[model samples]
Target: MDFSALNKSAANSFNQQKSLIKKVLAGKKVKCNNCNTLISVHTGADSVMIKCEKDCTDIKLDAELLK
Candidate 1:
């Protein structure tokens, strides 16, 4: 997604979310949607997919971070 249109506040929020995710995950495997558990991280990827632990829905990170 093109995030260039996001305002300064929104961009800041997005960055903050990314930072939080990095801190939380901390180089460990995470769960995915559709019951596929323990998905590993892809190195240097701009986007990361995180499954909702409570609802089992695939949430697209970085793009939705600014929304």
Candidate 2:
């Protein structure tokens, strides 16, 4: 199997995902530290889960960061 092609495909997917996420967050909202996507707000006990939209990676952000 050609690993180069696989790597290139993965890289292209990553780049596309990154660009899409960046375009969505171009308004300058708070970003998650783990995956670098815009932060999300949930309605529950915690009320907030900072996950990257592309990868769903979790990030621990401080409340003060919202300010």
Model 1 poorest 10 in a row by lDDT: 36-45
Which stretches in model 2 have alpha-carbon errors above 4 Å? 26-67
The number of clashing residue pairs in each candidate reads 0, 0
lDDT of 1 by residue, 1-67 (tens): 5557567657766775465456445865545435655544332356656544544544366644434
| Candidate 2 whole-model C-alpha lDDT, 0 to 1 | 0.53
lDDT of 1: 0.53
Residue 7, candidate 1: Cα error in Å is 2.8
Clashing residue pairs, backbone N/CA/C < 3 A, model 2: none
lDDT of 2 by residue, 1-67 (tens): 9999999987877765465445433544655555676655432343333456764654343445433
Compute the lDDT of residue 5 as modeled in candidate 1.
Answer: 56
| Clash count in backbone of candidate 1 | 0
The lowest-lDDT stretch of 10 consecutive residues in candidate 2 is: 41-50
